[model samples]
Target: MGNRTIIPFGPQHPVLPEPIHLDLVLDDETVVEAIPSIGYIHRGLEKLVEKKDYLQYTYVAERICGICSFMHGMGYCMSVESIMGVEIPERAAFLRTMWAELSRLQSHFLWMGLLADAFGFESLFMHAWRVRERILDIFEQTTGGRVIFSVCDIGGVRKDANAQALDKILSVMDTLEAETKELTQVFLNDSSVKHRTCGLGMLSGQDAIALGAVGPMARASGVDLDMRKLGYAAYGKLSFEPVVETAGDCYARTAVRIREIFQSIDLIRQCVRLMPEGDVIVKVKGNPDGEYFTRLEQPRGEVIYYSKANGTKFLDRVRVRTPTFANIPALLETLKGCTLADVPVLILTIDPCISCTER
Candidate 1:
């Protein structure tokens, strides 16, 4: 190793939307080491549990990250529910599952577009985002907000999608699937994208496990781990398997996400088809008296939420372990030995969500 030059990669870079700083130690054009630092966007959302009532804290959880807002809220709600011994309605469980999957689909599409843009494929980026718009429109009509849907509550969902509305969502999914196929084709087969991503930022399955990688990052390396299989919410009633790839590279992560989009679409269809008609929410009585921890499979990976209650309106403590936080070490590992030009691609592969990390 010759003279090492430290290059700051982010906190105000065009490639990354959120403010994440990475100090890159470079030897010529290759990255020798990458140390990531993030705190610029820390909102101390978990601390809000002390101020907001247990029921009201769902809103704070939702604001953790706009991209995975639904999952974050759902996780918090589930943790609270477990402590309160509240059982949600069957129909509401199905509704939460469908919405969660829709969030996953939208998140994956957004990531695909960003990945395209990172590699200089602007047209592909536009195409991917255009398809994502359909999902956003559905969210607006169903949840009253496009980004932060304040629909999840302690006992169940605040709103309900009727059968007709559910059918419309399925129709939209059909169209989305058709439109996404074109983008998927480009992402999977295009020579330029393959050259930029395939075999780049490789991590072995063993390394992934050792580094505590989660979500697509671990799944891409053939580590069969998905919190959904734990049967939280309607996942127990749904049938699906975790998408896995053994390549442990950027392309493998891309493939896992792409395949997961289709899987999420299928899951939504199943949820709507078998949904039971009943009240969307139930009455939750008494303050939470115990502590509970819940996990959910987000588009990025598994997120953990810990909640403690003291039989009061306000919770004692709430802690969130976002997926990106868990994957940062793996990200630093991949950055080593990669060409400086490919740094953006590797970062995008993890689908880094700095807002979630700092929250």
Candidate 2:
């Protein structure tokens, strides 16, 4: 251990946008181990299922994590729908997929900005956020919320975008794609950025799989596991593949997300093209009497939602397994042997969302 000293990194830190405490054991400036501590912002949102009616809990689900609210709500709704034997309208499925891709696009953009900010590239950070605002504008125009969109419901979505609106969304995505290309090139090709990230905090493919990593973290490590491939929602109708990088380092993680942004844009365009004219929501009836487990591919990773009902309006139990929670073990592993200065960027690579983790 070489006379290890302990340092607490978080609960409040400039580089960390969310609150998470890591007890780092350091030997001269190299981190030997990192013990993560969360729960600083647990709101007990899952427990709200006991108090709120099943139909009303979708809103609470959306509040679990602002960055991933739409997916959270969708997961809960999917679980309840599974239990209730409700088949959502075809049009609603396509719309949900479109919105999900939009959410992914916005999330990756936010992560890119945060990563840039962490590396002290202020101009890159600003440019990333500027592009992200266009995605948010599309959300507001269609779903009426920038972050916690209350559009997803049990049987289907509450709002519907007409053909013209869908066309507009596609146009907006094209514009965003054109504007982001130069920024993406700079991130991937710039020598300074490469020097800062290329080999730092490496996790091999086998290690990532053994550590139960998911989403881009696992994908970056060459573990080809995407819950979307399971054909939930309208993803079965779309043609896309998960973005994977074999390097499994900070740079590879960045590359995975950058590629995923373009993938999401392509997915949104496909969903809009395949959208059919029909009702967005079907009538949802009956109490959820059994249990169902639903999985969703959030921007961070795979999120599992479990819902149990005792033949009542209010659900008996709701449990969520967030991506960050699963990634913590991988986070701890990546921290080992890395220099103290690189800790924040390593943490950002997993795209930790403490609100989602602790919820």
Clashing residue pairs, backbone N/CA/C < 3 A, model 1: 215-301
Top lDDT prediction, candidate number: 1
Clashing residue pairs in candidate 2 (N, C-alpha, C atoms within 3 angstroms):
none
Question: Which parts of model 1 have CA positions greater than 4 angstroms off?
Answer: none
Candidate 1 at residue 354, lDDT? 93
Candidate 2 has its poorest 10 consecutive residues by lDDT at: 161-170
| lDDT of each residue in 131-151, candidate 1, tens digit only | 999999889988999999999
What is the clash count of model 2? Answer: 0
Q: What lDDT does each candidate get?
A: 0.92, 0.91
Question: What overall lDDT, based on C-alpha atoms, would model 1 receive against the true structure?
Answer: 0.92
Please write out the lDDT profile of model 2 over residues 9-41, one tens digit for every residue. Answer: 989999887889989999999999898877899
TM-score of 2: 0.98
